[model samples]
Target: MSPTVLPAACEVLVIGAGPAGSACARTLAQAGREVLLVDQHEFPREKVCGDGLIPDAHAALRALGVYDEVMDRAFRAQHVRCVAPRGGHVDVPGTLAVLPRRELDDIVCRAAREAGARFAAPWRFVAPLLDGERVVGARLKGPDGEHEVQARWVVLATGASVPPLVAAGVCERRAPSGVALRGYVHHPELAQTLRELQIVWHPRLSGGYGWIFPGPGGVFNVGAGLTGSHATEAGGRASMRDVNLRQMLEAFASVHAPAAELLERGELRGDWKGAPLRCSLGGARWSRPGLLVTGEAAGSTYAFSGEGIGKALETGLLAAAALLEGGDDAAVRARHEAALAGLKPRFALYEKASHVNHRPWLADLVVWRARRSPRILRRMSAVLEERQNPGRLLSWRGITKLMFE
Candidate 1:
């Protein structure tokens, strides 16, 4: 009998070394899959973010075996102090931990490497290698020119870089809604209040809010998020929106929270970096044939509070599990979607309620009442902690009464 040669290709090829990609690669490699993880940057890369992790995020990291390690290095935020534009403060119950995304990404990537995944950094993925009509792997370009990797499965964790794939007719972005600008800053004076994460809801900024998160040593991460449509609506007056954010935080610190000076000396690390937030509101495809996009690349970030890290980890884990099952491309897609079906309503509700043109009054009222009522504050915290859905706390009926009725 003729000798048979087993295939030499990898079991999985994961692109992007961010939390989602690294988490998926680590999970799959731990399960004994031959995984190759690739990224455009080397370890310790920085990502613009709020730098605070919700309780749910902690739970997700626990499953990946790096939760305890990361938490040890993280600064714990035990309360969420919120400032309102109408002159009130609310301290929501619960704890949010702070750790720079750079540290978190490196930890997760190292975990994946320890679990037997091959690492390919500083290699930009130029395109997916197509076998006729099927995606077999990817082609990457870097200092060494170009190289192709072959794998049974390809997972795209390339947050917001989805346009290149869409242009190549590999993936599609739907309900394309908004853009988000995020940057990192260092403020030493913000240390004493590092125990709490502050979110400011300014009425002047209709669809966006400001955040002040404390990392290790009281370094504050201050940023503002607004919808792209809102920016366009401002018609070159968008700078005024951020201006409102700055002025509001200054006033709040001077009177309500003396720690507001954390933001007073806020310095922009660089020009605001933004990415399009594609919404997966109902009927969005999770995967197609040979490729699967997870995390923000898949539009999995929660639309309401703009939470993505936890959901990205969850979806990444699920995507890895599906690829490990050893099925055809169609079967892999089915498993991925089924795993995420439970979260559809959460994503849908957030996308619906968080529109730039809708429900600003209702949202403000909710925040206002929560500031006045401790019970409401706790409920809001619970919702953010993902102990229960926010829907359970304020129903459509209650929201109506709170705002209008």
Candidate 2:
């Protein structure tokens, strides 16, 4: 149960109860730190996501000791079907699963609570409590009223919400890296037949892609995401493209026959929802003084695939490790920043591969090559497993090799 009265102080104040915040809280609480995890929403709240768990997410789940619990509830799959605009396709093998954020977030948060972290919800973070330039705590507004809670350290894991980052003075880019629209579809027959996760690239969804991932029961997670919106220009300037995610979803169904069949035959569950994405780790400062940023607030999502859950959890754990190392404020900040920087090169490779989202013909070429080449298929599978960089398959030299060698 949530605490009725807020504590006067704690060792760590973690904002947001998503995967990142929960992971951090659990890690710290398990280490015997006084942790308080708060979120604006209650447990099992609806979250906009693709709900697909790749290999990285699987590894993170194992690290959190929740892999068994999550897999027990997840819809397991072995491969992801990559569909090209010209109808050619390739099945990349990997350990994959799907569990909507509603259930997944609740399970992780519960794990944190089970680890002895104090969990609270429906408590919105108002602003940071400042001691000069250093963050000392936070002002939160709960059901009762606004209250202040002091802490030795603070963590921002708010996930794509800009207001809190702005309030904390860590926000760099105000615009999101991308945007996506998705809704659940209940179709028992379709779910039964669609065993593999399906990702389709089409001319209709230029600069974007659509996905149909089967979930437990008769439900399927259907969505379209556009990452080309916030592309960097020739001189390092970023530009935002005007897009209508709802219309893009419709276009996806119209162009992709499988998506059309699902939409026409399946019953739509709830309403179509949209969410913004921060990709390629390009937004927000990693840390200031006593506070550090993790998860989507630090741009943990990938530009190429829009997958973030794993990286978010990993970054959160990194934050906990930095704090656990027992250092001055500057040392902790430097540690977190260095860890994030190490991941930047991989993020850059994903960004390079995102070019396929804009020119989907490239996917057709890849599918065509993979159909005849066992080596290409192996590399593709390796990419899904995070064993190989996507650039190895999507780069110019890679394209040349695909066509000839």
Candidate 3:
């Protein structure tokens, strides 16, 4: 594939070479379409995340033909253990995997390059090029200087970032839906504990939670996060920046049964890092003439669990399919929006579940019930497998089963 310089145009221009962008770019290029993928950062750049991929994410990787490469470098997680504030817990086993985002993202992006997408890195998107209300392409800034690259269509995969959407006037500039702080930990028992993926909930963290996930090579991804709207949902008055995630993590690790056990067994391996977990629930318009939003920009992250990687790739592929549906730009936009709308109800319930997770009492009851009932435990396991919908928490039978189990 020949390279298209910044000043040139292509059939498709995908901004932000993350999972969503790469997925879209790869799909387009593999179909013999002209695609140019741009990113401000080079490969192997750091991206803060839990780094755990559930079964659904694996399916996405398989579709992209990178699952084997990923699995070769990842740790296959065995059990998912959820801990409640009252020390009640449930441990269910499943097929999950963990790999640092820095590595996994690079692999996915490179797959795009190999599949024939022209990739340009360290090229920052400065603004949108609009002809009337249509986004013709983007004005990008890089070492060569500012220039415009026109495209038949523009796809935004700029996760949790606002400037791209703001520049396009697709939505008002705002922050990500939530915040997450993560870091690596080296533990003597990390290798053994890699069998269990732990999610810890605490009363103090009404709108947030802590996690201890074992990674490959004696390191684990240990962290905590609070939804940006957590305070508002919890009826607290704390500012977004005012909360110390590291401190909260320390508190949970020192007291919570699951977190404390890991802390006692491991040593903090590096500096505690964090990032914003942008949500899909906001009022952001997903599509306009010649432009569409996928990935985190489309609020693809599940509000309750902060699980997005699967949804990110899902939306990317969905957008790609819409492009191939052979419609005008307006018809394409409608196709993508309608497909994404199917997830809105689930996303809303996930947000409500995030709110409910903040309530220690209800969370404890659910955990306590699941811990005892084999049937509920099986269903819990199914949720991780995507066989059961997480939104089932809103169903009457689901509620009865959860509470009465």
Relative to the unseen true structure, what is the C-alpha lDDT of residue 282 in candidate 1, on a scale of 0 to 100? 27
lDDT measured at residue 352 in model 3 versus the true structure, 0 to 100: 63
Using TM-score as the measure, the top candidate is 2
Q: Write the per-residue lDDT of candidate 2 for residues 1-405, one digit (tens) a residue.
A: 454578889999999999999999999999999999999998989999999999999999999999999999999999999999988899999999999999999999999999999988788999999999999999999888888999999999999998998999998887788999999999998776889899999988999999999998879999999996776778667777877888898899888887898889999999999999998888899999989999999999999999999999999999999999988998999999999999999999999999999999999999999999888899999998888999989998889988888
Q: Model 1 misses residue 157 by how many Å?
A: 0.5
lDDT of 3 at 342: 74
lDDT of 2 at 191: 74
In order, what lDDT does every prediction score? 0.69, 0.92, 0.80
Q: For model 3, what is the error of residue 291's alpha carbon versus the real structure, in angstroms, after optimal superposition? A: 0.4
Candidate 2 has what TM-score?
0.97
> What ordering of candidates by lDDT runs from best to worst?
2, 3, 1
lDDT, candidate 3, 206-273, per-residue tens: 67888888888878898888875533424433345467787888887776765666667667776778
TM-score versus the correct structure, for each prediction:
0.84, 0.97, 0.92
Q: Against the hidden true structure, what lDDT does model 2 obtain?
A: 0.92
Instruction: Note each model's CA RMSD in angstroms.
Output: 5.8, 1.7, 3.1
Candidate 1: minimum summed lDDT over ten consecutive residues — where? 1-10
